[model samples]
Target chain A: MTRRIFGVRTLGLLGLGLLLVGSYFGLFVAPAERYMGQVQRIMYVHVPCAWIAMVCYTAAFVFAVIGLWNGKPRWDARTTGAIEVGAVLNALLLVQGSIWARATWGVWWDWDVRLTTSLVMLLLFAGVLALRSFVDDSDRRATWTAVATIVAFVDVPLVYFCVRWWRSLHQTQSTPETVSPAMVLPLRLNAIAILLIAIWLIAQRAKLERERLRKEQVDEPARVTAGLEVTDA
Target chain B: MSQERKRRRLLAVVALLIAGGVMAYLAFGGIGENLVYYWSPTELREAGPRAFGASVRLGGLVEPGSIDRQADGLTMRFAVTDGEASVPVVAETVPPAMFREGIGVVVEGTMLRDGHFQTQRLMVKHDNQYRAPEDFKPEDMKELMKSLQFEETGT
Candidate 1:
């Protein structure tokens, strides 16, 4: 137990340190964009959040598949954790994108293909969370959650590729050829930092879920016995 | 407890207003009209009369020296060009912060009967490229490395 706690503590500290360093470099050390001016600095946090959000969803997808294949309670807990964390980041990504859009694109929001697909992705995952809550039976909930997650995974790839496949007002993905190496450093640092933080959060959330499952197991027999007593009386 | 509940209610109202206001300001009109995102000058030219008076986003570079801000200030005219074709535009809205000649832009409006694209919303489109204004070339990085090496040797 102490070892597990230590792991989380270490992850949080390391992630915090890297995030501070990355933001410092992004805000001050890195060169401000030419046409975009200082507003482009938002990309450091925004892109990382977007990338990690998708990473969380992808992990959730893999875990859901595993849970479905083997009907494991642990896999269900992990899938739940990943989806919840992914949704939070996805919401943050939209807000950050909106702010960047207002600064650079001259609008708070636009229904461009990429932007629309990302919003749909958030909704689809949020639906999975809601579905999990409505169902009372644990095994049935796990099965349904797994199926819903796999269906939602379809939108993740679309969000990433829509800008390339369609005529979007949002620009295509930036690359080393397009962005300066100096700009790339802080962006990469922030991505790693945020990813570490996400892993820590998912671990904690999954642990909580497992503990809840254990508590429910301990209560199941007593509740059933009480129901029988009332029926007999 | 009553005060806490009242505050919660007030917070909910404020949050709703902020979200609705933002959506109304930016999205209500601008979003659905831009489903196609943008049409190039070539496409607009090909569409011809079919494009007239229909809502569309005409996108291309703002041709250098084509900007004409009427003395009235509210009325500005510019030409959008995609090399092979060019479309003259008269915009009522102020250009975006980064808007300038030679920059890519998407203007939402309609093709007028008078052979001009009349736009109410003018937006700038930035490329996926980013660069420092000071132009830090790769040679500068090599020079920095060489200077660092010299310092190490002297130490």
Candidate 2:
């Protein structure tokens, strides 16, 4: 266990190093955008964060599916960890996006389809987290959250396609064809950095959850025995 | 697998499929209802009376030399045209810095009974094209700062 913790810490440090290097290139090396100027640099962090958030949500969805199919506590723990991390990243995406919008769009927010759908996705997953906390029974909590996660994931595709489906102020997805090679390097690097950090955090969180489950298992017999004594008396 | 377990798995699959189908239907239905919040001036004109009093968005290029800012600085009148048709718009807010003539814009509001569109919000539509201007004049930067300040104070 100590070795595993050390490994995770090492991975996190590596991610931090990559993030600093990526930011250096993005801020100092990349050419300034013609129209947006310095504000465009925010894309280096904002876009990567958004991408990782989506990836995390997709991971949560996969774990939820496995948990439901097998009724496994391990999968449930993984799903919970992913959802928590994904929600935090999604929130950061919104904040960074709003700052960008203020500089470029001249407004902090708008009820555009893309923005609205993204907000709905965040709220839906947040509701799942809240629901899990409200349920007292461990098995019931796991099952309920797994089902909710699946249902909530239906919004993910809608969020991705909202800009294309409806007239939106938000720009469409940027790809190699749309972005210059010089700009793409930092974007890719930061994406890798964030992805590595997310993986490490999720792994640590899942381990903690598993430990709690293990302790519960150890205490289950004692709890039952105490209940039996009270009933007998 | 036991017969009971097999039956349970089949039931779960069927249930998931039905739920997915229902969700897809509802999502598509919502999108269809608000598909095009704004219509081009030509579309709005074709809708005629149906467009009147109904809250909708009108999108088009702003007509050059048609903007009239009232003395109050809050009330403004302009014309939005899609080349095929034009609509007169009256808005009660200072326009954005990019809200100049020939630029594309989408205004949300409703067509009044008096043959004018009353705008609740005005959004300037910019394309993905990015290029630095040849010159970064200090005066232009000052003008931009002034406009941004005006927006902050006015709103």
Candidate 3:
């Protein structure tokens, strides 16, 4: 328990450190936009949320695959925990994107390619979580969830490319080459910070889940005995 | 050498293969083409000479007195000029609600196989400025400024 707490605390500090650096440059040092003025500041938060959400879902899918293959309780818990965190951040990205769009594009919502693809991803993961609630057998649940995760992972790149494939008015990516050097640093830092924060959230959630499962193991004699008997046999 | 461990390893490899296959196809195989087009009037003009007969964006200020509304005001032909280069555009569709003769506009179409500019969509560029309702009244604004004890600090 002490080790687990220490692990989570360490991750929290790393996340905070990254965020502090990100904000320092993003808010204070970066130059304002030539056209949009101060409203360009929204990119620091909106873009980072989207990038981190994708990273979280990718991590969740990896853990889901691990859990299904090995039938491990720890991996299963981590997969589910990451999925929950990813879903929250996905929703955050959608809201922030909408706000940014309204300020820049003069419209709150449009059935554009990127937006549609993101909504599809959100619904697919929501279905994954809902599917979890319907299953009682741990192994079967993990396997099915892993399959669903793999299928859903296919949509991440699709969402990224939706705007290009179709005629949409949304802006293209701000890359190192495209953006000014001063803007690039803060944008990159904010993205890294968001990714770290996502990992920290997943670690904390996974730890809590481990503790819950640990308690169940201690309280259920039948499960413990069955495990011991199987090992001995 | 345990049977369970071997099975787990095999399953993991299979899962990895599936993931690799899907990601490879999506990322490198032209399966994902979602990219949003963002362009300024300057960029459009720069691309004009080289973009012969190809579809591209044209954005600029709508030339005043150049808008010709058809029988239905919805279908209009206008000329967008960057003060140096101008293109005559025919809007096959209705113009956006905010579109006016003087504001900035962006049209998506090709500089025809000929030289005529034909557009499939017309979008009005939105400016970023907000003034409070109280500030809408000039007299009230002056009184509010006087009450705040503010004076001009610069020429």
Candidate 4:
């Protein structure tokens, strides 16, 4: 089992390396934005966190579907892992945006549609995680988490598209085509670095979840009579 | 087992129906009526009397040379333009440091019958396009460093 999961260590090392280089490029190598000047460097961390947070939620959504379909504890564990990391990144994204907003928008917060939906998205998923803790039975907990995750995942797309679909103070998405190559380089580097880091976090979190599931099965022998003891674990 | 399967199918169908209903609602008129975050100067102008004295957030670029700082220092007047149309604005508060001519901005306030939008909240709107200053001069950097050093040593 340790051998199987050892790949994540490599992921962590590479992610850290890229993050350092990417931050250097964003902060020093890349020129300050014409209008925003030094303040625009916040994009290096903010955009990646926003992207990876959505990516993690989308992963959780996929794992959730599989968990519900197969009623498998492995999928449930993976779903939880993605959701937990996603929520942390989502929270970080909000903080980064607030700091940026204070510098650029003059307000730390606003009730604009994009901002509002992102907040709601965080609440919905955080609520799902809260719901998971209240249930004790592993099977029931897995089912409820999967179900709640599917519901919460609905807000992810809304948060991403609201800026484009509506008139928003938050600018629309910045693609490689829209931005200069100098700016895009750091942004892309940070994006890939954050994605790899997110994957490693999910893997570690899921392993912990699987171990707890194994313990539960061992402690409650009668519950394991159905031969549904996690085969991977 | 067949009874259990039947119940599951029914639940699935109900969920799908709810999802479809939501999609329909969003498609019909929801985006236009409910989801508008802010209106541009053009839209606000077209709104006409409907816009009068009603609270709204108007978004647009600040027209160059339109800013007029009142004698009282608490009031500022400017024209917010969307290229095609412009809306005169009187803001009763300080604009953000980033606020400048040609920068996009959003102001929340009420529109008066006399065509001036009165605002207490002015927010700078930034674009996604990031570029280093093309016309940045080397002399400016030297001057900036001198200024920084002057501030630090207090000489």
Model 3, residue B39: displacement in angstroms?
A: 16
Worst 10 residues of 3 chain A by lDDT: A224-233
lDDT of 3 by residue, A113-152 (tens): 6788798889998988899778755545666677677777
Q: What is the TM-score of chain A alone in each candidate?
A: 0.93, 0.91, 0.88, 0.96
| Ordering by lDDT | 4, 1, 2, 3
Q: Write the per-residue lDDT of candidate 4 for residues A1-233, one digit (tens) a residue.
A: 66767788689779989999999999999988887889999999999999999999999988877776666689989999999999999999999999999888988999977789889988988998899889878877887787777767767877887665566778778777656678988998999999999999999999888888889888987776363557664
> Candidate 3, which segments miss by more than 4 Å at Cα?
A215-233, B1-155
The RMSD of every model to the true structure, in order and in angstroms, is 14.3, 8.2, 12.4, 8.7
DockQ of each: 0.20, 0.17, 0.09, 0.28
Candidate 4 lDDT: 0.79
> In model 4, which runs have C-alpha deviations exceeding 4 angstroms?
B1-30, B71-73, B135-155
The candidate that wins on DockQ is 4
Pairing residues by index, what is the TM-score of model 2? 0.80
Taken over the whole model, the C-alpha lDDT of each candidate is 0.78, 0.74, 0.66, 0.79
Model 3 Cα lDDT, one tens digit per residue, B33-94: 33324333444556766666677666566777898989976577888765556777888776
How does model 3 do on interface RMSD, in angstroms? 13.6
Error of 2 at A162 (Å): 1.7
* Highest-TM-score candidate: 4
